[model samples]
Target: MDEVLTCENSRVKFFPIMMYAMVMGMSGLTIMYQKAALWLGFTDMIGHLLMMVSTTLFVVISLIYLSKYIKYTPMVKKEFSHPIRLNFFAAISISMLMLAIIYKEVNVNVASMFWYTGTVLHFYLTMYTISFWINNNQELDHSNPAWFIPVVGNVLVPVGGVGFASQGVLMYFFSCGIFFWVILFAILLNRIIFHHQLAVKFMPTMFILIAPPAVGFLAYYKMYGVIDVFATMLFNLALFFTLLVAFMYKNFIKIKFFISWWAFVFPLAAMSISAMLMYHETKDVILLSLSYVMVGVTTMVISVVMYQTVSHVLKGEICVQE
Candidate 1:
């Protein structure tokens, strides 16, 4: 009985990290899938593949976390006890259904029916984020500050919603949202840097934190075309600098088995793709070509590194002592 209790305690301790990783993974996958959808013309086989991959991962992780965390008390089992998680799960389901509905509209009145359902889905996600994630964060006991990633990611959902609903009204709103979250994340990045002065000495967390919003800004541009190219490009440039520092300091060597390393690839790739799409629209031939080339090349290189890191971590070759 005592051993079983000890095992349960260990599981509880791991619950936070597992939840954090899963949230980050979901965020990365969502950003990647949006780009993949664009790349494949939204109707291509590749788009379907990307959607399937992202959806499967999200659902699986959510279920796993739910199973791990949901209480089975007599009162809770009655079905009204876990409203937040249940509502989030429901929002994801509705969002998926709406995405599928939009998928069938490709080339058939693309603009008219497309944005409404997507906007609704985004709003639902935004509601869930505000009502559940942020409100509950204080309740979760986490050692590392990295847990804030999901919170910021959740907040950005509304910007996407607003952008989708009305470009004129929502464009700056979306950009402001990106700016806000990036600032908050920057503070978190600094704290991580302060503490882990040597652990991730080679890799700076700032770039990874900034990459998503950069991607978001570019995505918003593609959706609304309201922002200046230089502004968005500058954000990406900052990200590039951060990545450069990370590679140089962290010894950008290939190590098989770290899942978190793969996390880096998705954001950069999505941003590159968004930049490419924006360049095409702005008629900047050189920049467009550069974006495409970098997207492919960097993804190829980073992917190999991420896969190796994952393998190493899984095999216990690169353990980080807490």
Candidate 2:
């Protein structure tokens, strides 16, 4: 009886991890399809397909995890279930906008805004849900150092996710929210630095959470000159910051492994490419292109690093996933 109970407990414990992997894998597929659409110039059709896939994934994952794995806080229970409802609304909006984009049948600006707004709604809901869980339940046991690594690291995921998705709306607000978000991120970083001895300063996973939203912001900045001056400056500063962090990691950690490193490189490259695209529109071609080239090289190196880490884990070697 005790053995059976232990087995059941193990299965329950693994559920969240499995859910995380599944959701993240779906995200990767969405990104891959988006890239494919861009390269193929079948943006109208493929973009719609990607949007559909993303919408489906978001709804399915949210329902499955929230219904089963989530242990809600009083705040979540009391506060209106706005996040969940908003996600459902956004999924619907995305489906409609995707159809419009495919048919080229709607007012361009309206369609663009729908896409932007829907994305923001989706990720903001995600961040809120994840944060509620983290604050309420996940951090109750701080004695486990291994848990802190992923938990703290993943907090950035929510932050980045929100920032990335809201970039379009953020630019309209003249980068107002973005400035505050960055400040908040810095504060969080300082807390992690002081409280946690983990040297995440050079960890590639940081970019995994950082780059996507930065790219989103850049995408909007390039698409519309909403806040070019501010966004450009911010992006360049981010690149410098990334380089500095990478340098520090190289100097201190002798990172001889790589399992989840690809996560970092993809987002970093997304930001770099977005920045270059924005700069190209502004005629700052040379520097931006150079930045993109440098980012591409670093991306490949990090991919190799991630591959090594994954290989080690599979062989029952390093237990980095914990």
Candidate 3:
């Protein structure tokens, strides 16, 4: 048991592990304002308060991890080539984009700045990740839903880009994201079905499969102001995937708690938020009820994970490499 814990501890570096917290915290805020606003009723005071808390937490965490990265250059470099670690860059981009979305109503100038910065950074990161895929001799057997991270960033661009960018620009990013989602989805699905079984630690990331479509649905609605057929398809697929993964809850429970469990949070939050948006468009009580249930589930899950993470940190069980 000691050896196993030690081995797992060694893999927990600063670059990406903290991103789990950043994404979850930000997603909570997004759900509170963007989706929850529909059912909970929005107020400027509450919106600003939630935004400030989530954004402050994200900025502080980013600084802490970045400082650690600079101080431990050797370790950072070593982890750069790691397939899973590479996805951390995407988390950074996505966090920035989330900030853009949150800030859009609060401060357009700041929101625009974050939107552009995140879009550009995500574009570069997507290229880098794809280049790594092509240049490295790594086998597709290692491919997992995490690969969707960078690609999904493209789909997410329109979520904030709709407000700050031209329709043409939003389409460019949206098209790119949707295009990559199709390719990566097929590859990842094939791998999961026929390739090697994912290790227990990575099982949580399977929830990532739910994100692109959920996010895409939200992005589409933002851009087009309607839940057209394409948008409906995206939400439906996300819903189906959510149910599919929920059936595998036993698999996730059997695994030990890790920071990667945060992977489950944002996707679930996205689905909840998507359902909320769907309720607004369709005025369907069923969709509204589903949104409420999802909100409860997402909150409970993140709360538990956050508590466990803090407990682990206090016990000195995290962020130490073997």
Evaluated with TM-score, which candidate comes out highest? 3
Per-residue error for 46 in candidate 3, Å, reads 5.8
TM-score of 3: 0.90
What is each predicted model's overall lDDT from 0 to 1? 0.44, 0.41, 0.77
> How accurate locally is residue 130 in candidate 1, as Cα lDDT from 0 to 100?
46
Give the distance in Å from residue 232's predicted Cα in candidate 2 to where it truly belongs.
1.5
- Tens digits of per-residue lDDT, candidate 1, 1-322, equal 1221223422432322222332333334444445545653343564456455545544554444454445423322322224322222333433332233333334334323434544455455445544764565533212122332333333333333442345554454355446646565565556555544423321323235545555566545546556577656645664575456456644544322333454455345545655656565666776656665655655574556545644653554442322
Can you give the TM-score per candidate against the true fold? 0.57, 0.50, 0.90
Give a tens-digit lDDT track for model 2, residues 1-322.
1221222322333222222322232343344334434532335564456556544644554554354345433322433243222122222322332322322232455445544554454445445544654465433212221222222222222222222334454344334334434544565466556666434422544554444245435544534556566566756666665666566665434554433343444455445545555554565666556554644564465446545644653554432123
Off by over 4 Å in 1: 1-43, 71-148, 158-176, 185-198, 201-207, 227-230, 233-239, 242-249, 252-258, 305-322
Off by over 4 Å in 3: 1-21, 42-49
Q: Which order, best to worst by TM-score?
A: 3, 1, 2
Task: Give me the displacement of residue 204 in model 3, in angstroms.
Answer: 0.9
Ranking by lDDT: 3, 1, 2
lDDT of 1: 0.44
Please report how far candidate 3 places residue 282 from its true position, in Å. 0.8
Residue 249: error of model 3 in Å? 1.3
